[model samples]
Target: MYKIIIVDDEPIVREGIRNRISWADHGFECVGVSENGQEALGMIAHFRPDVVMTDIYMPFMDGLELSRHVAEHYPGTKMIILTGYDDFEYAQQAVKLQVTDFILKPITSAELREVLDKLKVQMDEERGHLEHLNRLKQQLNESLPLLKERFLERMATMALNEWEIRSKMAYFQIPLSGPLFVTIATDMDEWPSEDQGTDNELYSFAVYNIIQEIMDKEPDSAVFRYKGNKVITILSGSGEEEIYTLAQERAEEIRASIKRYLSVTVSVGIGTICRELKDIRHSCRASVAALEYRLLIGSDQVVSISDLENRRSKPLYDGAESENSLISAIKTGSPEDVDRSIGRIISELQNASISIEQCYVRVLRTMLAVLQALLEIGCNETELFGKETRLLTELYSFRSLEEIEFWLKDMCGKAMIGVAETRRNISRNQISEAVQFIHHNYDDIELSVKMVSSRIFMSASYFSSLFKAHTGKTFVEYVTGYRMEKAKELLKHSSLKTYEIATKTGYQDAQYFSVLFKKCTGDTPTEYRQKMMVDGA
Candidate 1:
């Protein structure tokens, strides 16, 4: 109910008004009755009443004066002026104070009740309108994250002008104030499900959650999920080197956290730094390009575009195809393919009627390409070049084209050999690590080849092939054999129940474990235990 205060100098007028009306019926409660406006003001300050009814001619602080103070301090508290016929002029002044209504002396109880009823309806409508506005603000807040995600995706892919970018950034409350900006793209080495079926989406969502949690702690960094399986982050810093270092540190932290918490490994690719807001798209493109190099550098590590910048040079002629063929052959082809690819590149340069300087630049570009391919397979320049520290100066001193061709072919051959040997060592080490991981986590029911491969930072398919070649069995076969051997020891040596043995061996279903045990040993668990007990006795 709304509260109200009544004021009059005379006792009879105030008492009659308080007693005559059934205030509850009009949706108001008369909280107080005062002898003058001064006393009523004090009650108003205490109760903060919704309505004040006062006499105009009260001594020391009249009705108009009180209404003025109410309008200034408690504007929401409505004022009603009570006046006599001669005081009608004073009531006009009260109207300027935003008084609700004025009643002449001797107002009937029915008239007063009508005024209170109308005021109640007006207040209800205002309150309803206020409530509606508050709900809209709340809904907008709830959807802000989704809207910001869409905007960030667009900024990474689309070419937006500075004004459009800044305005949207402001609207979304993104804290990307960068004198220098770098973009980072990250994704799992392999999804939980290799086929990328229904479970892929769930795994990606979990990965995004981990990434978001870590990135949120970084200042001036924005993180959001891209497509379904990738996460994109933009980081801002004061200088190019500072931002690059920050990006690398954050990427490593994200990789480590995902590996630790989710049992998955993620590879992060960082783009070159850009200084302008509109150039963010360029950085984003560079980051994606860096991810493509994961095929050469191996996965589960951070790759930066700047690291390969020196190895790339513009093509002097139409040698792009030949260059690509040479790099590809060095990575995966036979020695004959490498020979053919180098011969083709040399043939093109020999046929071109270019000057000696152009020839030198073209040959140097090819050498850099070979070096880049070797680096991808974890081969260093010292391994390929040996004691020859100044390979560039030696290339410049060569006189005839034959000398250059021989040098090119020799480097390509070393690259091919290095690629093969490094890949072999990498595979051996990865398989060994996978086995050790399985040994430690064998009791986990959720363990699988995919999980173990991710922990070792290799793709599931590649890990499977390598695991078989090294261990002479498929991943499932090896893990099962080990678990079965463990289960047999438990059944024969201990008094544990069949179900308890099953749980200890990583099987959630005892019936399935029993069937598998019988299939592998030609005896059920209980029969095996009984036989072992009798043999021992």
Candidate 2:
């Protein structure tokens, strides 16, 4: 029920109005009656009624003045004007004050009920509007980051002509004439899911605050939300050197501040400044590419295109150099030749003034080139990458020449190992049947290669060779690795003791299980569990 207050100088008028209408029947409670507007205003503060009925002419402060104050201070409170005088001027003034209802002398019950009913409807409509607005806000909050990501992704890959690029830039409020640079940031490590709590909101807000603070330190600088954890900038009225210095200094500061304040790792990649909007895509690509060298430079490092030297006309290995050469070296199986190849690539890059930190990046790219070549030859090894292309697909994002070189080399080594092992194990039935055996009897403590082979209709000696050929793993090694992996999971997620965990992973002897766990993970099950708990995982 809505609360109501009545105001009038005459006691008779107040009593008559109070008693004449049954307020309860009209969805209101006449909580109090006051002599003048001043008394009513005092009651307004304390009672905080939803509706007020007041006389026009009262001693001290008048109703018109009081209505204006109510409109300002308590706009949600509905007002009904009460006046005995039949004056058009008073009615006009009341309307101007936004009085909800105007009832002149001898207040009728019908008019009073009508005003109360109107207020109820208005309140309901206001509530509905509020709820609708809240839902829209939630949707916008959830999708804004993703929408911005898609926008930037399209900008990076699509090749728009000069006129079209400028038109688009103008439409998006991007300054087209001056030096432009892009910097993309990414969250490096995963945070604990449960421990994050409400920290994600604060984390995002802090990232925005840092970007704003950095931009504020520069002249004629603009920052835009590029994507999640990324802020892009366009600095006008500055030379390329000035832009580069500002980005490097600010990125270093941001990295340090994040470590100090948020305790998370972030890497910033700065692109070269370009005057043309058509070249902004190159700047964006360069910024993204800089991130690939993070493994060598360390997390939170800022890398630029200028730091990497240009690539040579031909690959270190010429077009005539076959995969067999690389494979024969691996199968001779000397780690020394692979190491020497990697060393020469590094030395050449360094002599050309390329950064050593870009080595991993070169490795990644070479792997992709190798994968592409293998694909052309109809070689399928999708399962080697956990049956996903995301890891390989990201190679195209290398920014610097050094980054590209390092990624290529890394990719080459990984692919060589992944492909060689995969090719060695290519029998379908043997692998399929072995997988079935492992799945069905994974809980058996006495499960072994001998027991599995006997059940699957294969001799023990033949099964060992066939399993290795088909799965790139001997029977004993495969089962042990699988069991240890399961044990790791149980130790991390469950409250089970080491003995119980050993049993769960098919080990009857807890001591033997502990020894194996230590060998696989460099920590006992208890030690691993303790570390996970400390990390709040």
Candidate 3:
């Protein structure tokens, strides 16, 4: 209720005015009556009244003085001046104090009712205005996070000019202006298939918050959801080694936090520290590439461009020798040998730490080489590489290293069986024995035309000529191809090192093995493995 106080020098006048009106009808309550303005001051403070009525001609602290004091201190407390005189001077002074109303006393209930009704309307209007402002303030607070996230995303990706960037930065209150930047990309290591209905948005939001909590400690950093399961973090600073170390440390913390709190593990890929925002895309690609490499590295792994910087040029298996062996095995109708050959390629590929795309190229080359050699051996291309898109169309689409490896072995073994059934015999006894002997003892670096000729009790020169004539290749060519085939088998099927593959393939020097393999197969051992292990899902 709007509480009111009535004050006058005459007790009768105060009581008469207080009782003249039904105060409740005007949404008011007269809680006190005062004989003078001095007394009303104490009563007004105690009651905290909304409106006060006091005589202008009181003995001490009259109506005018009370209104002036209340207007200055409790300005919200409006007051009315009640007086017997029609004093123009008092009216002017009441205007100065901004009194609610100047009244000629012997106050009536009807005039008081009109004034109280207007004051109620004023109060309600003010409350509505305050409520609208509070609602706007609430909405702005809620939208702030969404705005900041979008702004950070745009700054990381959009090609905004300096003026535009600065203007928006100022408007959105972003403090980032990157001359250097580091980025981290994350992917959930494993999400259960049954949890497809899990709150992805909630999880992403929680993950983003965790990342920011770790990263923002270093300042000039932000986190955003770049993909469904991927949260990307960008940190701005000098492109220094310390900056990288800091980012890496934060990445480790982020990984641990998510695992501990979210009940899931995430693999993190740290990008190259770009020198400027304009080159940020390079860092983004580098981070994503690092994440993709984690498919080979495994779950909960953190890969950085810096970690792979020294590794990018390392020796990958050149699948040439492996390729030759596979083709030779396919052409020789030895499904066992062909299986060994494919296994050798897969094993060699597994030994290297190259990207999936690089592995894909190697596997594609080997697959094509096998097809090529099969074609050379009179195998039908359509029969071998069937109309089924699963082989060629979906070759790159295969997911795991094992899947591609198994697929290759299955296809090659099938082709090898075809070669065996259709192969026309050339010098049935002698050539067959030589080929078998070569396959069994190709690892002997001393196995040569002389040794083989001696085993057969034939003259060296005659045997060499006859062997070339029957096989359509020189004796040395046949032996090198056989040894290379053996080397490929060991490389693909076993965990043998390159030097071991070399010695087993009959080369005294591992470098010589690489050289020979390159000459014959058009790729180094490491290059071959890098191309074949293939790729990720």
Q: What lDDT would each prediction earn against the true structure?
A: 0.84, 0.69, 0.77
Cα error, residue 291 of model 2, in Å, equals 3.8
List the lowest-lDDT window of 10 residues for candidate 1.
308-317
Residue 196 CA error for candidate 3 (Å)? Answer: 8.2
lDDT of 1 by residue, 1-537 (tens): 889999899899999999999989888999999998888878998999988999888898988899999999998888988888566567679778999888887888888788889988987887788899999998888688888999898998888999999999999889998999999999887655566445777778888888888888987988887776689999999987788889999989988898999787888889989999888888988887777555434567888878855454434466878889889888884778877887887777655544446777788888887777687778877876787667679777554555566777787787777888888888888888888888887889999988998998889998898899999999988988888999999998899999999999999999999999998899999999999999999
lDDT of 2 by residue, 1-537 (tens): 789999999999898888888888777899999999988888999999988989999999999988999999999888988898899999999999999888888767777677778877886787689899999998888775555445445565577787765565555545435655545444433343656575665676676677668667765555555546565655544576766776777778867777677777677777767776566677776776666556444556666655643534323433123333444444444556655555555444444433433443454544545566556544565754446566535554443444544554555566567556554444465568778889767779888888888876779888788888778988778888888888888988899999999989888899999999999889999999999899985
Q: What lDDT score is found at residue 152 in candidate 2?
A: 48
How many residue pairs clash in each candidate at the backbone level?
Answer: 0, 23, 22
Model 3 per-residue lDDT tens digits across residues 10-59: 97888787888888887889999988878887887788998887889888
Superposed model 2: Cα runs more than 4 Å off: 1-50, 55-69, 83-100, 116-154, 171-173, 176-206, 216-222, 234-246, 256-265, 271-276, 292-298, 303-537
Q: Which window of 10 residues has the lowest lDDT sum in candidate 3?
A: 528-537
TM-score of 1: 0.37
**Which whole-number lDDT from 0 to 100 does residue 96 have in model 2?**
94
Ranking by TM-score: 3, 2, 1
